[model samples]
Target: MRDLPVLTGDAVADAATDWPIAEHRVLGRGRLNTFVSDTVVTPDGATMVRDYLTHTGAVGVIALDEQERVVVVRQYRHPVGFKLIEPPAGLLDADGESWLTAAQRELAEEARLRADDWRTLVDYMTSPGCLQESIRVFLARGLADAPRPEGFVLEGEEADMEVCLVPLDDLVAAVFAGRVQNPTLVVGVLAAHAALRSGREADLRAPDAPWDARGAKAARDQELGELEAP
Candidate 1:
């Protein structure tokens, strides 16, 4: 049997630790801001500067059709300079939105899809080494084609986006073959495939579940800002 996590208050505190930020500075600002320097001090007097991006987190949806196929969108990422296929995902920090609401909006906007059933599939950090971004994947079934939100226009690369419906088995093959490598897409597809293969629904977290790290990190950053105020 797998070891269960400790759910005590102290254990929870330890699990959601907010590292002491000795100093913090913003290097640049944009839609997603950058924290160019953050001095972290440990209890043992060790200190280090961590340069990482600050994100509001995001959500991805794996919309499944009645035929057991999943929808994917193709768009170009300028930073990577490669066209990538991924599930419909949107930022959580947008306008102080909830995770479920963001996922639902992204589903409609990206894939022109609506679903009757939804469940949490997996939650992941895209790049832990240098990014503070986390994305929660949701499995959405009972899908039907729908019109995009009124007066909401797709812009830039999204304006030319392409959508495709691929069988879950084939998608798993592509994921294993590295043909479809978007983290959210790969994780969501493989997880949904595994769950369906086992003929059982995976135990899922509540859609509005609280994410400790996102808020805890922000609070830590806020405390540092307060200390720096003069």
Candidate 2:
């Protein structure tokens, strides 16, 4: 295997400023820095580079129930132009909560269901070229209905959302028929399949789900062992 190239710089040099919608302060810088700016592109395909902030990876969950139904939410995505089907997910706001904790919180807030079992599906980079956005996906099962958490409203920015439970077969058919098209959801479904085939669904947990450095290594080891054994 070839080693990846690493760049080291003491300070960030602001290159030539292109036309931006609005100028904003830089959020961070180092390996990757972030800035906030209004960047817009015309319909004619003209490109406009603007100031934008870079962020780390986010988390998402594909919560399933005992009946083989997958919990999904229909939310209006500004960039997508309409409501899209997606699993329960959200940004991690609390400083110390683990990714699995965020997944549990999102599931409860979006679907009002708390899963008893969870197995990580995979870690994915949503966009790597211009933006630094990674998403961690999980497979949650053994769900039960519960009360929505306090202050768990998708107000203002996320007001137009409808949550539902969908059958797994329906989801698979949609994928094969070219209906479900989100990359994160696709990865989650494929991971769920591998978990089902190997009967490894019992391993993922809220306190110990593989989302970080050591947990990720352990999960990968378990998966590799399963593949290598008879």
Candidate 3:
């Protein structure tokens, strides 16, 4: 085999591409998400129908306290049938809410904590193949106890959620040992670990950083009139 090409600086990044949708329709609508089918025309002129969920996106918070412990919550996920250990997270379904505001709200609601310092840890698509769910995870420090958001009554799984602080190192270990499988937690833990270890925590993105993926999705949603269609 020839010598592997040496990769250099930050040329590797996700770019958005819009595929031509010949037809689109809503297959179903859930309480918080929409199931849609799209007939896409490929560049080669072949058409394929794909079904996926159009989500309202979400935000996660990795609340790291002074002792380097990370706030986590164990909540039951019905679809996966597991009480997953995850960073506090919630959907961005509220009208006119910013992602940073949503993250702060979820942290307060799920963990009953707030942070004076917030930075973007990472952003990811839960499952791009079949879900348009994008999650922005924030690294939160300078923690303090806070009351739950008013009228945010916990029900079902939320009512049973258990919140605790786990050491960042322990969470990282659990992630590698396959003990924790929640994607947001795993990514946030690892990202926080990497940043702290490399002393690059200060270089992390601002809490209000621009999210191109979300903007692109919103534009596409508008173009398709997905939210307005009855």
Candidate 4:
């Protein structure tokens, strides 16, 4: 693995010190929505940058089954003014729970699948240039059926999601065809693919076919190892 670049405390402090907020305003706030505008003096001091953004908490999953099919959702997106095909996802609404907990809830709500295997893939800014929300993507496996929660319904909202299963290669091809454009979906799918490949390699390296009582545990361990590290 390539070593990541280190950032010193002094460097971060210098950068923070250079940022001066001259003015700020609360643009608006509605159900699960908050908007704000801020004026910041740039490092060069030639111009002031005014930033406006909306903030929300988001969660998504790359759900895979023993058959290797990935669960996806088809929903209408108003922002893009079109229908979008993507993974099971939703906004975080529960208080006091960690982000991963919210991800598990969404996975159960959207796809009705509870994954015995869970791993956080990445935390990323969805649109740093305009939005203040950060999205957490997770990989889920060893799925079992669950009853859909009552409060987790998204019907009558601006979205109507239909759950579907897609083969891995077909989904990747759709991504390249511009059919799957959601950012979180792309990242989560790729991460799951890499994890699956790693699990296969580990199995090949094992000395024996761990098919007895030890076999199931060995297989689960391989999956967990690939998950936790990424």
Number of the top candidate by lDDT? 3
Pick by TM-score: which candidate is best?
Answer: 3
State how far residue 105 of model 4 sits from its true place (Å).
Answer: 0.9
If scored against the real structure, what TM-score would every candidate get? 0.87, 0.65, 0.94, 0.73
Candidates 1 and 4 compared: the better one by lDDT is: 1
Residue 184, candidate 1: Cα error in Å is 0.5
TM-score of 4: 0.73
In model 1, state the lDDT of residue 39: 89
Steric clash count of candidate 4? 1
Q: Against the true structure, candidate 4 has what lDDT?
A: 0.67
lDDT of 2 by residue, 1-230 (tens): 89987656954432322232322334455554344443455556575655544554578898877777888888777767766788888876577888888888888888888888766677765664455456788887788887788876669545767888788778877888888876766777767766776786665444454444334434533543454356
Error of 1 at 74 (Å): 0.7
Cα-based lDDT at residue 129, candidate 1 = 61
Error of 1 at 84 (Å): 1.0
Ranking by lDDT: 3, 1, 2, 4
Q: List, residue by residue over 1-230, the lDDT tens digit for candidate 3.
A: 89986767796678898888888888998987789889999999999999999888899999999899999999999999999999999999899998999999998899888899999999999999899888999999999889999999999999999999899999989988999999999999999999999999989999889898898888878967954477
lDDT tens digits, residue span 148-210, model 1: 988879999999899999888899999888888788988999889878888656566667666
Candidate 3 is scored at a TM of 0.94
